[model samples]
Target: MEIETRTPAEQLRACEALRRTAEARSLDILCELAEHYEVSEDSLIEHLVDRRIQPVVPGPTVSEFLSLELAGLLECTPLQAAAKLYSALRLKYRHPTLHTAVQQLDIEPHRALRAVDKCAHLDASVAERVTTGWLPQQLGLGHTAALNRLDKLVVEADPQRAIERERARRKDLDVSLWGSYDGVTTLSGRLEDLDARYLDASVDRMADVLTAEHPGLSRGQLRAKAMGVLANPAMALGLLQRAAQPALPDSEAPNGCLGPLCGTIQTPLHKLRPRLELAVHIDTNAVGCATGSARIEGAGHITLNLLREYLSDIDVTVQPVIDLATVAPEDQYRPSAALKKVLLLAFPTEMFPFSNRATARFMDFDHTERFRSGRRRQTRLGNLCPFSRRPHRGKTAGVWDVKQHSVGVLTWTSPLKYVYEVSPGGTRLVDTGHDAWRKLDW
Candidate 1:
């Protein structure tokens, strides 16, 4: 299977020889060579014929071939190997029709993988029905809708089994906040409906008050503050007050006062009142649907029920996420609010792609608009264009086409037309993993 290789100079000479113009003179020489070799012109061009038949040996299954490719292409890249391995597994088990849906329906591979995961536990009929019936139709329904439809189909096929499975899932419920590390405490476990609702309300109420007083808190900080307040609002306030005051002398220090130099002192940063202005995109249609799924900025699944319960005490402003469009010269200032919210939501990390560092709140808004200069049409996003501006730019500087993804939760995403990603730096951008958002090199 090994093919001989040639040096660049040798390849160049070969290319020049082969590319000698196939005009009459060139053709005459080629014809003479063919005759001397006892071969016809058709035989000389036989390699170009399209193969309607499968290869004689059929090389290998996609999974096997990809494995070999991965070994060769990613010899030292563990991360890529792990990622591709998952894809290979999916490819191995993926039904032929699912592959067709991916090609014809334009479903992204990751999304198709999700659909595959759903039906993985069920019968082939379930996956087939979804791939054939719902996936192909771009009926303005986002991926959530298609998934929901598939779930409904699953239930209709076997209700008792679905209910039993759901009940079993409900049993895995517990609440825990592990010991703190680096001033961060991990919270896990599930809650009952009433408990979850109460917790959300408590956090929201505290977050509203905190955000109002301190307007610059990012969503994570706001949430942490809210939860801290919920744990013991009175004690939390007292601690804040103590931290705000200057440190006392060694002996004069209060009984519990660790003072300004305390390793964990975070009152100053908290007092600044960081904003929790996260942009959550959700499909409006999926919000209340039985099988609808929502994500809080890409922080895993946040069902509408949970989102409503969690944000009950927090003020929310709903706005349309217009499509990417060119800003007309006539419109004066940019219509900033909506676009800024969308960009921040999409790029929560506020990262400068070049620096590979998180902005933490210092990043500015950049508009990489479509079609300018001497190039073909390009994406209208920050990464591609060398356009960076302060956080709050003109209201509508680069709006060309306004597309509205359905929902607006914390880190909202349209699983179909667009995919949102949360970077290691905590920025939420479109999942540029696939060819979907080539503007971002991620």
Candidate 2:
């Protein structure tokens, strides 16, 4: 058979095609061609391309190169394998101690490689054992240098312990845990017998030192003491519920009826309910207050503030609806003649002009000195009805008399204190006071 002597470029292209074919699982054909040509694979490859071909691929990707490298190391002493692995890893991750420590060990290259790989994922102490215990002991590299090298490896592997050690090195220093809550309630306190199981094991572990100092108490007692220390309303409610169980009699029950005490307990917990908290704030402002619904954990402090702002001065009147059907058909269904006062003296007539019907009329006096100069002033038209004091006989005054005295004209008024200017620091009273017809700002 005649073989053609191809040009350099043609040879290079053929070599590349062959390399691709080899990668595609056709290396056996290349091997046969090299054998038939009576030339080494490298020589055949070199003839095609002048560039140096790597004898082995460095890492684990190609199994053939690893096998070749492993076999090469086996020909040398056990220490050589450790040294090679150390050198390889050092080059990869730039660890200075790896090479030196591997050289100092007497283990065979494969044994050292296996040991190091086994301990690679472990923490420091175990990694050190690979070097000191397994490598040196088995490979017969018994030397103080090997032990020292192992120690260095251990130190390099674990940094958290080093940080703790450095922390302990400082003297007269204080370390404390600080918690800030946007909405979550934080509980911190000492307990006589905190149940190790009931509480978070992490938190319990943190309080272990304190718990040890105050021993001889049951877990429940410790938890109770911790609750007492924290004075957490939620925790107290939980404890109360636990105590209220029929199986568990209240050993430390306070001197009071459980209903009232439970009501008192519920007062704070209920206040913690976001809707109830918002409702209370609304009610305080003579506003329409309603807790549509609430989700405990989902509610945040920001939401609470927003709810307060919305309900600040809003007023809503809920008239009692008389059920006429329940009454006798022939009987007169006369509603109560007394006008129900929805709001009265509690309303700030000075701040909010709308508190009184008569004062609300003067709200049109916008250019008054009290309004212009921003002074605290009170309204001249009082919230009291005409019949509240004395009945007026004049025509206009008679209108007020009829409205106040007649049962059909019965009306309720809501009085409110106006806030002209809210202070920057939220200390409202500092720059706010009463003025005639309008609340003033200093």
Candidate 3:
């Protein structure tokens, strides 16, 4: 039981056992709850297989209220609870062999669930046949290999459906901006094949042009700069025209010429300007310091040198700094802009257990203690914390018991008596020797 004495391999085996046990326990509970409701047995209908009558694969359909009740206990939104319940039911009944393997700690539950997900659209009879036939061999394969095998089985079972799924997936294209970290934002998405190739070629072309001028920059760094260069239509068009000409040797290329045609292109660079709003909060003393850090609104922490590099050419509109010490508690329920800004600076992400790391700026500033109409200073910094809409609704519905023990420290007690401590640092499960969350035997 002493983790310090255990070898790394032993620790990993212990962790694997605990993870399987937890998932098995969760499936048991979900199946029990699903049985409480009047589950439809349509998919459970008996069918003739190899001259014997057998029950087809089945899954439960629980009442909507059950999901709401489980949401608070699970510390997740109702939609997530329902999805988990649905997946658990399918895993338990539709793939009984895999389910038993999970319960016996022979295989990971996620791998089995991945099989269930891949074959979910097939008919109950087909799904049962596929899993029952392939479960024995695929159980020992690695995660990715197992999933690939399952996908092949699904394609073999229902080729028409697989074709349809492929066509549908190909049509799903989108571009999105994810969170910023270490002074860089991530842009990711799925794109059509031809468009992706075109974009890739364009980026390489731009990166090549940038590399001719900035020899110190690496290829990856030049490619990143190429994305920004492509954003400007004037610069993009000029680069395209220059690309039509013959290639310049590395030695013959003009150094320090970032603009198109070695700064000879006459097109005005500012004709189509890209506007961006970036909010950066810094301490007064750190403004001109040699070594200090600042917090970008969407991005996390950034060093002063990196911040200067990011804002070197961009126009910055500075706002007067508010003295957080002087900002007093307000009598109104709604918090002021300054107070909200202070809270965003304090807590960068929403203050809910198992939250999706939602930015604090987009969350609802809810009072930890309910606001009374006539109470003075009810909506204050100490009493307010940001929560996403679903978590806020769950709290409002009295499903969870939330107690703010001190400023920036809160404890949440679920209906099932699962305790979680939430603070500015992070969230952690509180072990209170409760039966529900007792220490597992590893």
Candidate 4:
């Protein structure tokens, strides 16, 4: 009945062992359940697999495995449980070593995912470090700091590639907000170094306005209150429109998205002017069919039947895959303005099942031709995957080695070859990028 004391490092190591044990047990139960339902155990312990063979279609990948009881056990909504299951399978297939390391490192699943994102495009040495849990150990220091070390390691491994990757990573910055159950709202999110620095300065400057009322406010409190001020809709919007102006707009215009004045600007958004840029690509004829759906780029897909309720005065950008042209596939890297206009056409709302984030920008302009080794071929060598944004990391991590996957579609009774039959020399829309999201766990 005696408990021995352990050092912090020993405790950490013990915790990691416990985490791995729990994960293994969980996978065992899930796999057994899958067998009971005659399902693929692939959804469980998917990270252990070397290569991923995606589940067959024409049937449910989720409903067949997920139920109310399973959802409750997992502490998530039924849809969320399904999404988690699907995403686990996808990410595991993409990063077998990383997932294993995550369990071994006792890192939270989501944080481990972000680590994978940061380290996905590194040299073999860096990847080997990741597999052995050397890199992830640094994550305990802090997310940003750990990522900085990973970046430095990659740079040391390959300076030129590091520079190119940094440029791409810097170009991609996003700010988002989510609500909590506490009734009180919260504002927090990931921001890159440059933007974070700029926001810090801006918040400091704006907090000065509140100095008279609360002279006792510390720098942190000032920054917090400044964030509250920034939360004001009118203040935020006017700031955007006038960020380029001579002087920034102050607390003048209404503080809401509604008419001239309102407090809760967030609520009346569905009624007020549209703010989001929604791009739809679904055929008009098959509007309300279950088989038919519309992809709202950047947000995923919705049933075509809900089109009336979902869309009203929304402006849509369309990019249609056409029936061939004088332009060659190799020449079509970045679409020209005119070419983009012509490319806008109706496409299937979703390609892969459980794929929710089918954005126009995420589709792959995949070449059907096989890749020939050497001798000056259009190998898509330098190009990055629009979604993962990883390419040429001394291995095929971001880039799949397969030149083409033969996905058959049944037209009637017979099966047709190739993934999609885009008018021989033409192109067709594909959601290859959105099988899993970059920032989102699901």
Candidate 5:
């Protein structure tokens, strides 16, 4: 245990191993806590129902509160204790795969517990599928991937409910501004796509004009200024008019034209419209069916009928499908725009394990096995995966290693020697704990 003279790499490995051990032990404690807090079958329901009695049921049960004993034992807030109890009970009784994985110290405790919490609203069968089927596949990925996958599963399980929720959400739409002591205010709200698009265009137009006035400001700063300008409709309108004015020769006019806003003063801000390019993936069986679900680009999943209703008011152009299986990989190192689009569509999210901050479209298409120049057929579908900048750097720096098993399927090894497999279907923790640690020495 004495590490005063140990190398930095050795110290890092020791710390990582200890951390994994601590996390595994923590899960064991939570399971024990759940057993301790479980409602006794012998206890009468009438006793708990009494108005004078404080609710003793653990977890997020509507009327029940965490028991004082449980909170005291955990040395945490009642809410925190309750949440812990909830995750433990759900994992042990319901999500067996997650339960075993955590017990074996394969997956992170927080990640597994959060998965339980996200699936709290699901029914028995669907929730079972989530833990036993879908979760095991996505376990290698980060929390955000798990969250997004959970949402997709929930929508697919009950598309009608998702549609209803979307409808109810629309009814709750409201815009509000919060003022802060930092001399700045935050404006945020959800709006219908049509209205939001128009507003976005107006803001961009105004931002363009503001750019001329504030030459040193970033585009984002200019946009923020534009939002303030829009608060005064008359001033905003006059500025838009001036911005739209055609520029005369430099000799005739003192100032040149505004950037994108220069031209056609006749096209008022109100007349501006937004064009959207939307792609929706639908299951073959669910085509033209109310029960089927469709996943929209950027958005998760929705019922087929919900998608129809959403597009009803808009002008939609249908494009022929490009069969990904048939799309052959090009020989060149740099993929063509058309091929890049296919790749992005093929893997919508970044390929790195424990990463979901960026979509594939915003990521670099990394060669799974380092691409060598003049190598024939090196830049192929199975050999390529999307990687974010940080992970890409790590991979290049030899801090992390990757092996592509097949198209969209990859296995990665961390500096700590923990192994994870990631694919479009989900992710899996291939190796971990003391066994993996011991093997490193062997």
Candidate 6:
């Protein structure tokens, strides 16, 4: 038997009959059939209605159709497509609700049409979940125009850890204020334990004095003036004392707990300020030749005694020599051997100046240069005495009168050896056999 092909209308009627039968069995069966036929449940119901087959239950209403489309289950009608677009946008982004999500789309019908189109081919469950759960909330985004801005912010915000690291780095910069102190300058060790209270009191006293001196000054301006005055060490000490007094529990007990505070405050001041003294000496050989003999008689003896006293605690031997060769080599004479040896014991052996012929030759050359430079210029003798103006009869000698100028050459022979007393507290040069009143170059 040959089968006849059905017309379009007849085919539609057959599909509707099949759908009704499926619906009568179960809605699940109808849904399954809709999926198998690649048609929406709403579309299948519409087809059945067109064929004059009444649904067992009424077919989905317009609103229900829209809802199904929005949930991404059906996609036949334009109204349903708009609902789907709205639902998908709302659920995908959590922050903005469905209403806000719709408003964000801007383009009226086009936005709605796009949402439905995007959801149409997706699986029913997947489309529904994406619409309801993920797309509805706004991810802090206002519109498509604002998307680029949000993306930039997200990229920039990723460096929070680096910013925190930089903050920590700034804190470290604040902690390293202590300067180095290893004896490369005059301020080493000496300023290590300065007194702060003394400095504070000194500054206060200065301020009071300046205020009394000028009554018209404002307090702020006065403070600035006082700071300038207190830069002096004497004034600084007074100011430190004044600042520390209130902190002290008692006047007599001021030194007790203030020890560490003194160190803490004074460390900075010590670095800012320093105390210094300078001495210069000029040695003249002429003066030495004339006075050296007389000075040496008493000075040498005094120096020897000073050395003995200075070295009392030290185990090293002290020997005084009138001739340099006795202590140094014959060919290599050292003028500062005594001082060099003493310093060598305290410092490194390599720092000592060794006795050498080159040094001796250099000293001799310097002496010769000084002598040539110091010679007095001669002036011509005008009109010799008539009795002695015989043109110097037999020998014809030239008569010239020269100024008797004294040539003083200074020779730095060596550092003087003197006894000096030292304790943990301080050091002082001793006056054993020498006159303590006489000041010596150090």
Give lDDT tens digits, candidate 6, residues 214-301: 7998875676666665656654654455444444456455454443334234334334344422111113343334232111211111
lDDT accuracy of residue 128 in candidate 5: 67
Backbone clash pairs for candidate 3 read none
Top candidate by TM-score = 3
Question: Each candidate's TM vs. the true structure?
Answer: 0.32, 0.18, 0.72, 0.36, 0.42, 0.15
Indicate the TM-score of model 4. 0.36
Clashes of each: 41, 27, 0, 7, 2, 44
lDDT of 2 by residue, 354-430 (tens): 11112122222111111223232222122122211111111122111111122112221111121222111111221
lDDT of 4 by residue, 174-247 (tens): 66643422222356676789789998887876666557658998977877877865656565544334332333
Which 10 successive residues of model 1 have the least lDDT summed? 391-400
Model 4: residues with Cα > 4 Å off, grouped in runs: 1-19, 27-73, 77-117, 121-130, 133-151, 154-165, 180-183, 190-195, 231-442
| Cα RMSD for predicted model 6 | 45.1
RMSD of 4: 17.2
Cα lDDT tens digits, model 3, 184-214, are 8898999989899999998998898778778
Model-by-model lDDT, in order? 0.44, 0.32, 0.72, 0.44, 0.67, 0.32
Candidate 5 — which residues are off by over 4 angstroms? 1-6, 17-93, 139-152, 172-182, 185-189, 232-235, 241-442
Off by over 4 Å in 3: 1-86, 137-142, 232-235, 238-273, 328-347, 360-363, 374-377, 404-408, 430-442
Query: Candidate 3: TM-score?
Result: 0.72
In terms of lDDT, which candidate is strongest?
Answer: 3
Expressed as tens digits, the lDDT of each residue in 1-442 for candidate 1 is 1334457767887775444322213222322322232112232233332112211111122211222123222332223443445433443344456655444435555566566566555555554665556565634667787678767766776677788888876787988755434324588878777788888776765666577657999866887877866565444554455444545555455553445433344444334333455445567687557655555553445556666776675556665554434322212223245444445455534322211222233345432332344443232233221112311121122111112222121221221222332233332444423564346331
Better of 1 and 6 by TM-score: 1
Q: Cα miss at 431, model 1 (Å)?
A: 30
**Residue 237, model 1: Cα distance from true site in angstroms:** 9.4
